[model samples]
Target: MSDVVPVKLRPEILAQRAYKQGQPAPANSFKLSSNELPFAPLDSVVAAATGATEFNRYPDAAATKLRQALAEHYGLTAEQVLVGAGSVSLLYQAVLAAAGAGDEVMYPWRSFEAYPGMVTVAGASSVQVPLDRDSRVDLDAMLDAITDRTRLIIVCSPNNPTGTYTRQDEFERFLERVPSDLLVIADEAYIEFVTDTEALNATRLLADYPNLVIARTLSKAYGLAGLRVGYLLGNPRVLNAFNTTAIPFLVSAQAQAAALAVMQEADSVRARVNEITMRRDEVRRALIDQGWPIPESQANFVWLPCGELAERVDEILRQGGIVARTFPGDGIRVSIGEEASTSPLLAACARALERYPYLRREEAEAE
Candidate 1:
């Protein structure tokens, strides 16, 4: 045997942390971790997926038909659109296209856990700006972190974990301050759950900002998490870079067809979103009433700044047959799916409070 082991790998890959996906509980257990839509795919979408052909052939490299549908739905042209296996995949591709060795990518810490992993995997440095007291992105800090080596900035509106969004005017101001040469990614994976009229629509900003890219997914509101379809909208040049970095045949034919069908039934999707919003409101109110530290969530999830109580709360919920996402030192994030009943979530919260009275006492003292 050779004295040296035969291994070829970048040091960055070794140092990188793997993405922690939401856990899947046993059948019939309430799964409120991944922020999946509460409803199932429309009949049209189901039929499209089931009847998908061309399994023997490669999927459309361009995803032309789906691109056209998305463009029309978003009032953009086909050239301005690109589809990927999912928003996460598109995020990885965008990071690769924009940043490399010695470059820095800026994003809010605790916003998206995947940001750091993606940046590190691309052989770039990650600059995580801290969020504000309200758990919203600290725009001033983010601006200060920008250096000549900074090549990309990712903004997750209605940010994951926090469920708070940057207001429209604030976003416009930030856009004005950011350098025009740097690529700005607006990841709106939870946009469908947003009910705020004043929220910034990242797609509308694309025309004014050539470097802007909006990454959206069907995994959330469209109830197609399993199908894994997502798209990016941006300038033709930026999109070309994304395409060059993307894996070939990344999006399957069935996913593409299902996404097209989902886009066509916009009304049905909106209705489901309305239902989720109602449940989200109920859950938020119940938590606050129980003296839990709950933030105003615009996403299809609620964030509890319970800190160490997160693990305990997660355990209680799991024991109660509901699985929620816990971020260790951060907190817990519970998805507001259609199947998520207010009674169960409220009961879980109450049980957690009962088990850990100090959590409630601490919040009370802080207030």
Candidate 2:
């Protein structure tokens, strides 16, 4: 509870904590806390953003050209695309549009930490289905949790923090079972990092399901995190409803230009993503070899299931000049950054594992 305010405010709002970004690392340490791209922005993208120097004017309220380009890339009409500051903004708009007091928003627990807060801000309840033993979203369990009050469902593929993805077949089955009138958001924020052929892309099934929408961002693969460009692809009507709840001209002109430029730099972006994904695999393999019991990661990060020793592990990594995102009592999320980060990251994990030998899967099971 907070101290008394001068004016009245929603009790729930008072109780709710604000979203916290990943911690900043010291100068000598690699900040692997946020799952950010390690590479610098492409020259073309930077030039385009700087070229939009009309500071006196507001951005295009509709973001028409960028939306059209994205539509063309995805084989859809411009109206089917709704661009926003970032995918997170679009998600909040969707929740506010579809849910309200007494309504429920559903998603996997231990998924994106932002899910519950979005629901709360919408005056809606959150129904968090627990992840399976492998830390993957359990689609069957999600289907079983739907209630009449449920207004929105979010499925995060290559789910945040854990780095595990939903299978395409399982997702299709889950979507088929979802009520046609209900809205389902496939949050593919980290889709570009996924190397697994069987991982759910969501866009492939967008044509078949009007109730389904895809939320994606250029932040990860295209390295546009600072510009905050993201979009939604789905039925035009559904996007229209979401747009109604959006703040006007929130996407700046520079951001729109950067988005357009980045779209055209797909080859370069893919190459960068390939390097990160390869590095991610190598890091995961090394950790597993060190008996850390790392989960199979399809995203640009790996999960270290440190359990109650998360704080200690985080400290050890910090001491080794590596800063990872640590969830107290849960685990750590080590992002795939520059190749130079690998040695220190591995060293930190090895030290943690040696100190906490029971953290290994085999050791834990035997205990």
Candidate 3:
């Protein structure tokens, strides 16, 4: 496996590295690195996946049944729904359908790491707007970055790593400022974990804004991370254009079945999501009380802005039997997991703060 290739490849792609996943944990450790649900697969979900015996045949290329179920759940027509292997895959398809070389795709930085690479694949450029001190999307700065070349903008509410959400009213105002013709994707992969009523749920705003498309996934809340299934909702005309770029039969039959079955257990999903939200708030509060300068997280994880000490802190957490997602010099995101993992996570952070007292200083003071 050397760098020597038999044929030419895209230089930009070769220059970029493949996506790096969160580190795996040891046998005895808690793996909170990926924002995966800690619970085991539900009985119904397991049965649904196992029942799909016809693996010899290709899956429905359009994912017709799964799309219909999702559409009905949201009170939208089936045409408004478009299923994919995962929201990540749908994101790639949408990007490909929108922009190409010389076009600009706008989204907040430190949001989804995959955005830059995906845009590059589409032969487009990324216009990253920096997040505010609280790690929330800086709407004003993003608005100012828009130009005639801007074709698409991705808005990640309860944004990744940081876990800060965009307020509904603020986002509405932000939308009003953007060009009507441009596409605005609201990536709400973790929307189920949001307890704040003020949080932006873009599906509600879809009818008013024909330019809007909402991306959601069952992988997080439905406890089907292995299924690799997600869906998009938008005006049928806009979504149809996106559909043209999709990879055929990307979602397996089992994934569709699991998604359909999980949709029936709404109460179960709500209870589980509620638990994570409570744990998320508890961890955020505990870190703040410990003088760790943690941001309020509205998602299923809490962010520790460790800056240069991110790797060291990550090692510390691992040693304490909790593996978290680390961003080198930036910070660490610890997903809310089983109740048992909570104490070890907090203890590790408490110890980390004691060792690096400078990290506990007020933001202004630390600078």
Candidate 4:
């Protein structure tokens, strides 16, 4: 028998690195690596999920009812809404719909790791604009990176890892410089957690920018990460493209029901968001008080810019039965979960600081 494999995968697929998600630690450990909502789904959402009777049948291919709910929530029409399995899936779909072989996709480096991978998988070239010193998206640099071949530009505000947001004015300036034909995807996965009124809501910008697309999810702030439900809002033409590329019945009946139910309970969701915001601030202050070099996080997490000290801090936290994300030579990203989660993380931070005083000193000196 021949030992050789029968078929070779696509060149682009072969060249891409496997996407890595935050690690899941032991059950007893405080799982703070993934930026998931600490609270459980509200009673209304749970009831909606259980009350869904269509599990025996295929979900609405277009997710009509769910889209309507989202449109009403965001003051958009159902025609402008496109639902997907998750924002991650919609991201891939949007990139695929915009760019293909020979085209280029540009985004901020270390913003969303998925951006580069999605571009590659869609047979497109990736141009990464490095972040600024503060680890915020360098809008000017990203605009400079754009070329005729550029088909899509992704801006992840309250960016993952860095947790920095691009203000409205900055975003508007960048948008003015970009070509109208190019698709601009604003990934607002952490939008609900943002406390700043000046933060740009891509949805509000959509009416003026025909090529703009905004992807949002119930995963982070709405506590529906496990449900894999997210939606995209954009011009009818752009949304039509997403609809063409989307998988049929991508969102499940239960997920749709829960998402719709959650949207109905806006006040409840806002209350939960308020709690998370307070906790996030408290955690940030606690870390700063301990002399931890943390960044200003508008998301539900804090970023420690300790570079090589990231691994050591992660190990220390792990030993205390807590898990934080370590970006090897970059830094650490710690999620602010429930009070139960934050207590252990705060204690672990104290222990880590005590054990690695020299590392902290080095970080301070380098800064």
Which candidate has the highest lDDT of all? 2
- Candidate 4 lDDT score at position 306: 64
| Residue-by-residue lDDT tens digits, candidate 2, 1-367 | 8677979988898888888888999999999999899998889999999999999999998999999999999999999999998999999999999999999999997988888888899999999998988899999998999999999999999999899999999999998899999999999999999888999989899999999999999888889999988999999999999999999999999999999998998899999999999999999888888887777999999999888999998999999999989999889999999999999899888898888889987985565
Across residues 1-367, which tens digit of lDDT does each residue of candidate 3 receive?
8868778988888877677777788899998989889888888988998999899999888889988888888999999999998899999999999999999999998898889999999999999999997789999999999999999999998899899999999999998998999999999999998888999989879989999999999989889888899899999999999999998989999998898889988888898898888888888888888888787778789889998999998888888999999988899999999999999999999999888888984752558
Which runs in model 4 stand beyond 4 Å of their true positions? 1-6, 358-367
Please provide, for model 1 over 1-367, each residue's C-alpha lDDT reduced to its tens digit, 9 standing for 90 to 100: 8745479878787767798889987776787888887676689999998889879999998999999988988899999999998899999999998899999999997888889998988899999998988889888889999999999999999899899998888888999999998889899999988888988688778889997899999998888999889999999888998899988998899998888888888889998989888889888988888888787899999997777667877888887777889998778998886554567778888898888876773554576
By TM-score, highest first, what's the ranking? 2, 3, 1, 4
State, as a TM-score between 0 and 1, how close model 4 is to the true structure.
0.94
Candidate 2 colliding pairs: none
For model 4, residues 248-337, the per-residue Cα lDDT tens digits are 877889998898888888898899899989999999888888877677789988887766778888898898888888888888888887
> What is the lDDT ranking, best to worst?
2, 3, 1, 4
Q: Between candidates 2 and 3, name the one with more favorable lDDT.
A: 2
Off by over 4 Å in 3: 361-366
Root-mean-square deviation of each candidate, in angstroms?
2.5, 1.3, 1.2, 2.2
lDDT of 3 at 112: 85
